[model samples]
Target: MTRVAVVQSCTGIDPAANADALTAALGRAADGGAAIAFTPEMTGLLDRDRARAAACIVGEDEDRVLATAREVAARHGLWVQIGSLALRAEDGARSVNRGFLIDGAGAIRARYDKLHLFDVDLPGGESWRESSSYLAGERAVVAETPAGRLGMTICYDLRFPDLYRALSDAGATILAVPAAFTVPTGEAHWHVLLRARAIEAGAWVIAAAQSGRHADGRTTYGRSLVVDPWGEVVLDMGEGEGVGFAEIDAARIDEVRARVPALRHRRPIPRVEIAA
Candidate 1:
């Protein structure tokens, strides 16, 4: 069994402050004997203002949050997953929501950019046009890690099951879905969706999330979860910010799949024509 830590924290407009919070959280997770630590989305900055966020965004090499995380990971001898960092885009007009998997030696093992942007107009005047200021990623990422074959995804990608299926097909045993979800949607669909993903893929799902109101008045639903292969929620950090840990047993995947065999039972969809 691999002990993994999920960090639920409130991020604000300041990158330095966010980095500090994450560093402390990493230390706590290490103290708890966790081998891998996962942080929430937008771990660097959470400002809504496009200009201010853009100004605060820096290249991955120059990002204070990433640098701090690397240092902390090295110090603790821990594998750190920075859920998603807002980095300055090469085009200079937008930013990239990027997730990094750092090894115990503080070297980046893999990176995944968020593919599906959260572009929606919600009720109560809540609107987000993420595509306007964030470029969508074109590829999915699955990395080999000490815990298991890890599939990396971010906030909005949870809505897409095909991505998870693709990752599962690529030999992923653990799926990391670090998010900054809105309260309404999170309240209604978060647990259900995460559990469904775990059952369908027959893989462990680790979701570290952002919670509470941010500096820009936007609130996030906190309930970072670790779902087992049988769709059981092993851990849930309810409605607050902190670290949650769970043990992931690789044998659970084999046990669940041996019973259900759903993945092997999958067949290609057949085309049907409509007759008028």
Candidate 2:
């Protein structure tokens, strides 16, 4: 069994303050004997004002949050998966929502850009045009981690089950979902989708989420959770902002897969044709 920590935070506009929040959470996770720590999306900065956020959003090389996480990971000898950081794209066009997997030695093992951008207009006039500011990634990414092989996805990506299926086919034993989910959607679909993905893949699903009121005056549904391969809820952090620990049993994967080999049973379906 691998011990992992999920960090729930209400990030602010200032990178420095966000860094402090992450640092404190990481320290707590390390002290509690977590081999790896997972944090919510936009862990560094969560300012809604695009103009104000632009000042803090820089390329990955110059990102303060990335630097801070690397330093902390090295100092504590703990692997850290930063959910997602809003970064200035190299092309100088739209930014990218990127996630980083850092080893215990502070080396970046893999990076995944968010494949799905949130471009939705909700019922309450809460509209988001993520594509206007962020470019979506083209590929699925999976990498080795302390818990198991991790498949990375940001908030909106959770709505697409095919991504998880692809990841499972690619041999991912664990799925990492880092999110800054709104209260309504999180309340309605967050838990259900996570559990479904876990069961479908016969893998572990660990989600770290942002919660409570933020500096930018946005409220997030904070219920950072860990679901096992059997679709069992292992841990739910509720709306509390702190480090929560969960035990990941790698054997659960084998046991679950052995019982119901859904991944192996997958079959590609032909394109749908509508009746004339």
Candidate 3:
């Protein structure tokens, strides 16, 4: 069994503070014998203003958060998945939600960008149009790890089952859905949607999430979890910032697949009528 640690955190405007919290959490995970550690989306910083976020973008080579995360992974001899960091885009006005997977030796193994943009209207006048400030990623990524083949994804991507399905088809035994989900949506759809993805894909799901209020006044859901292939909640931290750990036995994938054979049973979709 390979053990993975998920870090639940509240991000503010300070980059140093965020990294400090992450480093301390990493130490705790190391002490717990975790082979891999995952952090929430926007692990480095979280801001609400589009113009301010755009102005703070750092180049990939110069990103402090990624560099520090790589060093941490190397020092602990564990794989580290740093959730989406705001990256400088070509337009010089927008950022990308980028996920990185670093090896035990501090080398980058794979990276995935968040493809979906959270542009919606919620109850109580809550509205988020992520596309206004961010550009969506077009590719899917999966990396080989000691635990198994691990898939990568960021916040808002969790709502799209097709992405998870594609990741599973690409040999992802463990799906990482790191998110900074809002409280309203999270309370209603978080657990059920996460469990559904695990069950449908027959893969272990590790979701490290943002929690509490941010410096920008946005609130996150913060129930970081590790679910088994059987859709069992192995580790759950409810509504707070901390670290959660779970042992993932890769054999469970085969066991679940053999029992249901859902992947093999999939059929082509038939044409349906649509209103024009």
Q: Each candidate's TM vs. the true structure?
A: 0.98, 0.98, 0.95
lDDT of residue 157 for candidate 2: 93
Give candidate 1's TM-score.
0.98
lDDT string, candidate 2, 125-241, tens digits: 898888889999989999999899999999999999999999999999999999999988998999999999999999999999999999898899999999999999999999969
Error of 1 at 230 (Å): 0.9
**Candidate 3 global lDDT:** 0.88
How much lDDT does candidate 1 score? 0.93
Better of 1 and 3 by lDDT: 1
> After TM-score superposition, what is the CA distance of residue 88 in candidate 3 from its true location, in Å?
0.7
List the candidates ranked by lDDT, beginning with the highest.
2, 1, 3
Residue 159 of model 3 has an lDDT of: 88
Question: Local error of candidate 1 at 227, Å?
Answer: 0.4
For candidate 3, list the clashing residue pairs, or say none: none
